[model samples]
Target: MITEDNDPRKGKRPDPRLGSGEAPDLGGFTMEDGTVTFDWTQTRVRLARLADAGPVELGRRRRFFVARDDLAGVKLEFVPPLVQAIPSTCQSLDEYLNWLPEGLGRHLIVLIQAGASALGLWEEDRLVAHKAIKKYVVRGHGKAQPTYLRSKGKSRYGSRLRLRNARSLLVETSEKIHEWRNESGPFSRVFYSCPVRIWSGFLDGKPAPPLSKEDLVKIPLDVARPCFDELLRVRRRSLVGRVRTLGDEER
Candidate 1:
């Protein structure tokens, strides 16, 4: 009958076995009656702060949480380089989905940019498929845009060029998504992290494809590097079936 509080060992180190896959600790949850719930409130706050911190600060915070008494038995589960929450406005995405009736969706993690996109087909927290868009232009740089402005159709012509680029980018992205579905998709929803302005352009611009209910999560474009690193980490860790597993736009 070990309770959450009152332990004299308030900052003991976690068990090394907790993350070795030999009886790994997957954190903990509370169950009352037949319902199970995880207290993500504090975890979400911690994650938000971590998302804004630098490498040195991140390490400091990680070490702090790793010694909490409440997390003593499961500290390793939430630590960085494992599976971090990576703060999002959609922090409650998974929780909201859990409230649905049933069979409504699957987990999908996407990292998007104006120039590229990465899609991950996740089964729960495990990534089952990976897809990417190399270099698609919504709008080009320098001479990529026409230098000459015709007197007759200058504005209209420029609009058409932009639209053309947008459509091309959209078509390529949709094709990849469609291929994923055809191969093994029909995903329930997408937890996407992309620049806010770029995403808005994609959605608001004409000839855009439709998205499902509450799918996109607008994260700053600066987070792309760290996000990609996190994805690679997950992929490498998943190789063993056991192992373990943002920034910039605010200026």
Candidate 2:
């Protein structure tokens, strides 16, 4: 359970709808604080109780519930840990809730930007291995200068160099990821955020990382510079579940 002392929304004013006595139309409700989070253990317990007491609506990334009596119109939305993917076999809400993992298991995080990338292998909550790579793939202006850009002399030469370096970075990153997977057995999930422009290059490397389409879960939060510490921070945030209150209209 999240306490008021450490709640992400502690300093913000409580939503007025939460205090209003009128029955909220499903569409009339507003988002409350999302800082109210639950760990996997707490999440499973809470979901189980809700399933027993009321009906649940499931979505790809979230779940919804409404209670009876005084809580009839208040909707509760549950967000699961972003690092994990819900199994496709759970066709019913009960089955999905029952299948929730007791805790986060083995996973890999891959963060990539224009000229830098970071990788980390984690078991439960501990980061066992990590690697960070940097290369001169982007020009000083912060954009990737295309090798095909029609330019003269030095400008053209620089673009070609940057393009070559970019390819090298992709190959090296893919090799490292494959090596880690070999050494660590297998990762249950691979959470990654790579730019669209570089995604194809990474996947088409001479020896691409052995990542399955189903197991490739994208990191949902905005990340800063890729580094070892940033990987740890992302892992912590991924374990936290965000809550939003919906109105009857949301049903």
Candidate 1: stretches off by over 4 Å:
1-105, 136-167, 182-185, 204-210, 219-222, 225-230, 233-251
Off by over 4 Å in 2: 1-35, 60-71, 146-155
Q: What is the alpha-carbon lDDT of model 2 when measured against the actual structure?
A: 0.65
Tens digits of per-residue lDDT for model 1, 26-72? 22333232221222223443334333342112223222122112322
Q: Candidate 2's residue-wise lDDT over 103-135, tens digit each?
A: 567788899876778888877655677899888
Q: After superposition, how far is residue 16 of candidate 2 from its true place, in Å?
A: 36
TM-score of each: 0.41, 0.77
- Cα error, residue 80 of model 2, in Å, equals 0.7
Q: After superposition, how far is residue 163 of candidate 1 from its true place, in Å?
A: 7.5
